[model samples]
Target: MSGVAKVVAFMQRSWWRAALVFAVLAVAFVVFGRYAVPPSTALTSGALALELVGTRSGAVAVLRAFEQQHSVHAAWVSITWDFAFIASYVAVLVLALRYFARPGEPDLIDRTAAKSAVLAGAADCLENLGMLAMLAASPQQPPDWLGFAAFATTVASLVKWVLAAFAAGHALWLAWRKLAQR
Candidate 1:
């Protein structure tokens, strides 16, 4: 078998390991996300707000809010941690899909769903990069690129969410079908 096929086979057999890593990453993500919340903002609200900020003005507003609450550093910390979370989630989702795939030739839907998970992770990474760029810029004297960054970030975030939801939903459907057959 090709190296890629071999790796996929290995991952299909190691879904539990990916799941355990995902659980750890999820808890860490939550803890860091909580820390990212500004005093004036609701719990984990800042993170979501940052992700959805589609304009330079919106990005500045969110950044200023975090600055006022002295949580800008915390926000950065949380976003950095999110990189690891993205990897864990993508791995677990892909592995789960592979594990549940039917025997013999791979189903096109299963392959597409697995690819979606990877794409979602890539989009998430882009979103995080854009956010990081915005965070590094001063709210009062924001860079000329801030607007483009904000727009791109929002786009990436939306794509990430949509693809992830599709992948997760497909995985659940596959699981249900498999269980029903038993």
Candidate 2:
């Protein structure tokens, strides 16, 4: 069998493990948000405002807001913690997609959902890097590249959310159907 088939086989068998890890990571994510990171108004903004601040001015404003609230370090910590969360979520989603597949063959939707999970992870990584870069730059007198970084980060964040939602929704729907049949 091909490498892909081997991986699918492995994932199909390890779905429970993936689900366990995902549960742990989800709790950790919440803990990090609540305790590890300091409370701040900037951080409490909606997801899009936090991740999709597309314009340079908007990015600068966010940075300034964090600084003013004395939560820049908290923002950094949150982003760092998110890296691990991304891995866990992607793994769980992919495994869940594979779990719904036939013994040796994944249907097109399953394959697509798995691929979307991976792509979402990649996009999230890009968005985190861009946010880090923006944080590194001076929000007051932003660098020329800051605008591009903001735009790119916004795009990546958008892609990540869309793909992740699709993958997660598909997996949940499949699970729901399975449960209903049982």
Candidate 3:
């Protein structure tokens, strides 16, 4: 098999593994996410964002819970969480960009891939900015409950969904493209 053929075969074969990993990760997050998050003085962004947000439970709760469990200060946890969040956001963004980036030598496939990558990269940036804004608003000032709600819904949830949608769209597009090529 050609390199591209091999890559495609690998992806097809491992698709179930990918889905399983995602499922397991989701379960793990549901179990441990509440503990991993630090107390929030502000709103959440990035992965914390949701499409259907409830004003009742949110990032602040998770953050507080994590801090209490770990017996650490919110201040310290915030710093560590901030870095980890940023790193995760950056890593996703880079991967998203590469999804469309390798347009093969001026060919249409290359161009299409490049466009997907660029869009994914842009999504990553927007996601990062949203996350960064949340991080910025979180420190020192005690967060207004209304502000947290808004941040959680608008900045956090909206951004998270947008990124997910983009990723899903790219995946479908790539699959179709590959199949069409075959």
Instruction: Pick the TM-score winner.
Output: 1
Ranking by lDDT: 1, 2, 3
Instruction: Report the poorest 10 consecutive residues by lDDT, candidate 3.
Output: 45-54
What's the TM-score of each model vs. the native? 0.82, 0.81, 0.36
RMSD of each: 3.6, 3.5, 9.0
Poorest 10 consecutive residues by lDDT, candidate 2: 32-41
Tens digit of lDDT per residue, candidate 2, span 57-145? 89888888777777677677778877877876786677666665545566788889989999999999999888888888877788999
Question: lDDT tens digits, residues 1-182, model 1?
Answer: 86445655655566675466457657765664454443445216777888899999999998888888787777788788778778767866776676667877768999999999999999999999998898898999989999999999999999999999999999888878877998
User: Which 10 successive residues of model 1 have the least lDDT summed?
Assistant: 34-43
Candidate 2 has a TM-score of 0.81
lDDT values for all models: 0.80, 0.76, 0.43
Give the CA lDDT, 0 to 100, for residue 56 in model 1: 92
The residue-by-residue lDDT of candidate 3 on 1-182, one tens digit each, is 65433433443466574455445545554444343364453323323432122332454444444444443244344434444443343333333333323344335644454344345444444544443443334323436663454354455445545555655465556647755775
